[model samples]
Target: MTHKRKIFAGMSAIAAASLVLTGCGGGGGGDVDADGNVVIELAQWWEPELPDGALRGLMDQFEEQNPGIKVELLSGPYASTREQLVTGAASGTMPDVVGLDGAWVNDFAKQGAIADLSALMTEHDYDDSQLASQVEVDGSTYMVPAVNFVYPLYTNDALLADAGVDAPPSNRTEFADAARAITEAGDAAGTAMPLSLETPSGVQNQVMSWLWASGGSMLKDGKPDLTNDGVTETIEYFDDLYQDGVFAPGAFTMKEQDMVEEFTNGRVGMMVDSLAHLTMIRESNPDLKFSISALPAEDGYDGKRGIPYASWGLGVSESSDHKEEAWKLFEFLMSEDANAELASMAKAFPGNVASVPDFVEDDELMSQAFDIYQAGYPANEFTGLPVAE
Candidate 1:
């Protein structure tokens, strides 16, 4: 797909100067230092999840290869990053390079907040075929997924055993029953539900996942279809759980991190969570026993299940003055070796079609998650929608 990048590239020097003067910190000044080095900002939520300084080490490697370019990492939690990036986009002061969520792609592209990646690819003669599916807006690419993380049901083995549940739930009925059993047996809630409307990703990552588990969708022919039978039933099912007091307390204000924390502390019996959090949970509570499984499906459907996923999507900002240098960092991260290393560190799958995460072969839990991913189709309807966040 061909699209013009002139609109982004043609931003005037005066406007660039204004953005530099008023922008938030973290390499917000896209300028060459006195030492003749170009400093480009890399903003995202990935670094905190990585081994301390691991992502920085990778950037050091990139700096070595590209002598005149330097990268400044601006890392934070997802919610904070989203807020900062949104404000930057609004004021024409976004960082040089950003880690994107597919959900934010369409809105950013529509507002001319991110560069047209399709044009960049064509200009650089990059091989798009090696990458997994991308996020496009209005027929032009804007974001490249660097790695993929799937959400799976994480059950506290000890809690389940204590509750007298024999196995992980494989269907809706069994899941609900197990959750209730856990609740009745002890102080722990049956499931951790993060429904914070402030962050709102709970809707995308948790609630929508239930419908997907049963091969359902919120979109019909690329439009809102929330009134469908699948959605109606999914809502009712969750409502019943709510009435039964099986959902964790503070769900209305809980975030994904809170959900993971609850599961890690044995406060919840089960949750559907990102595989990327495996390292954190293990590091936080070494003795907590848990098992990963595909989310419970609607009973006896027997078709290929729909797996929910999110990506560490990469993009260059339209407001960046160091676009060329930003593109270099983006390219390095997407390279096969780099992509594989990142996926392994995150306990996720590589976005490069030819890259494979090495951890899956050694980690039993990761192996199980990979198998679940293989058996199901990736199902996320918000990937390229406006106001999806």
Candidate 2:
């Protein structure tokens, strides 16, 4: 299967040029090991998500190819990893190569926690044009998206069928009706929404997702446009669902992981979630049946849909003594073959524009997602926002 890349026009270019911080943190580089190999510690939430030892196997290949350099993975869950990175940034003890979220680029750059990739790219003669997109801060590249996970509507076939729905909803009215019907059919809710105030990204992933799917934007001229009609209608639509009792219980406190689990356990009929969870969902419920589609739009919307996406971004620590060696790892990861391998392993879209995943040819759900992606634009407004949690 061939994928024609779509321009990332829906993603708001982060241009926080004037933001500044006073401190600099560096001194977290790895040291020489017993065998005289240069050790570089990498911290991220990606390894656990991949197949057991898949990432390790990739590192093993990297170690073999690049002799005398060792990579140590410090992997954990998303929440803990974010907390750890935040703590590391403040304490000046960040790992050499870190998995970054687009939202963290601005804050980390302002604090001087992450290295300037533009300089390193120039020094190494890296051709960044092949990269999907670079996260920038103060006009300097800070992070590169390693792989992309798109949010699509996931519907349980049994639930929809039991609710008397013929197909997945494609517009707002149908979605609401489907949700209500599914909820009325049984104990399961029509949809599961994670709106936890603790993490607050649910607002971005769930609430804002509705707006984006309908070709709406939260920004105008790079500024907040909350007062716009689109945002107002989106909020009203959500409220209508809430008033109709179509949303799963404990929505206000429900986290993203909990929402995915609910869908996996047959407690929810539908959800707009990341493709990265496809593997997990299948592993947890081998017999479960589901389908993926673009998030429903407004009734009259004929324009390109806005698909929300998150990235497994990569960046190096500002203070690492092994910046050069760390970049070699970065280069290896971004290489076409390696990037494609990672994307396939995670069931995601590659971050390298030239790297296409052949795994989609055999996977029905992923093929649908790839089609949806090619048809629409990536809509992640929080990509470079400060304090974007």
Candidate 3:
């Protein structure tokens, strides 16, 4: 299961970066015990690692290295993570540290469920730019990204070659041509788009990306604006692609996961999904060569680099007496050694730039994912509702 990473010709290098503040709120949850040892509970939705494993190895190392702090994990699936944290926070029973979704950061900050991490980051000299999903609200930093995922366009190089598509497309017009070429060659569907209008997430994969890349947004001033000019233009472009037979017939009904399978099975030329799919594809379609890049945009439209920001991150409960201790554990887990463990175990990339592991740095495909994620985009967490526009 080897992947040969691709580099977009004539594309400049990608830059990565991330935020904000208020409240002496780090004093409520689990705290230090009578033995002068701090006991911090970290309840996260990230699998600690993949199935059949956990992040215990890294924690074990951390505990051995830092004798005074004891880190406890409250494990569960991501589906119920937010509910658990929300209920716990409301009851003042939340863990010392908790896992957060990108969309939850702002609300939690407003609720004062999480502590400000600026001071802690500064004190530890943590280079924050590495965080793919660092959560900031109204200019204050609330959380540091951990298990982050980015939805990038993955193309099957072999399919593209077989279709005689010599180069990747940088704009929609060019992309359509490439897609047409692939379809005409009969190697596979040019692309598999996720467009099940059944859910907001479906819309995101098939459309929101284009809006953001074209300088439009799903949320403006806290309200949903579905009729923005950029959105309309994107829709028109999508319509053109559809009419041209650039997308598979099932694309309009397929969920994101289904499209992922289409790409891996060689039934589709490209897939719009998480970089994690690479590992999955490696297992399911071992001989495939693929490359990933940000979704294509109009040639002059911000060069089509915009996309959404999403991740799982570490946050200290507002009332944790052991804020410093909690941060210590976080820093350790996000360190180079421990972060690498996360990649191998959880199929996650490092949230800290300094901790990028070899598996990423050594592989062009994986390395490119880090670059795409770091290249900031006009994003909306798209939580529940937008503020009044």
TM-score of each: 0.77, 0.80, 0.78
Tens-digit per-residue lDDT, 1-389, candidate 2: 22322233212111111110111123475778899999898889999888899999999999999999999887878865776677667767788899999988888898898999999999999999888777876678999989989999999999999999999999999999999999999999999889888878898889899899988999886668898999999999999999999999999999999999999999999998898789899999999999999999999999999888999999999878888899999999999999999998887888887787888899888988988987887778888777776
Clash count for candidate 2 is 1
Q: Candidate 2, 389: how far from true, in Å?
A: 1.9
Candidate 1 per-residue C-alpha lDDT over 1-389 given as tens digits, one digit per residue, 9 for 90 to 100: 12455554344333444433444353433677789999888879999988898899899999999999988887888866776677678777789999999988888898899999999999999999888668877678898888888899999999999999999999999999999999999999999789888888898888889898899989876678999999999999999999999999998999999999999999999999998789889999999999999999999989988888899999999988888899999899999998888888777887786777898789899888888876786777788888876
Highest TM-score model number: 2
State which candidate, 2 or 3, has the greater lDDT. 2
lDDT value for candidate 1? 0.86
- Look at candidate 1 and tell me the lDDT of residue 207: 86
Candidate with better lDDT, 1 vs 3: 1
Question: Candidate 2: where is the Cα deviation over 4 Å?
Answer: 1-28, 31-39, 64-69, 76-84, 91-93, 122-127, 183-188, 265-267, 283-287
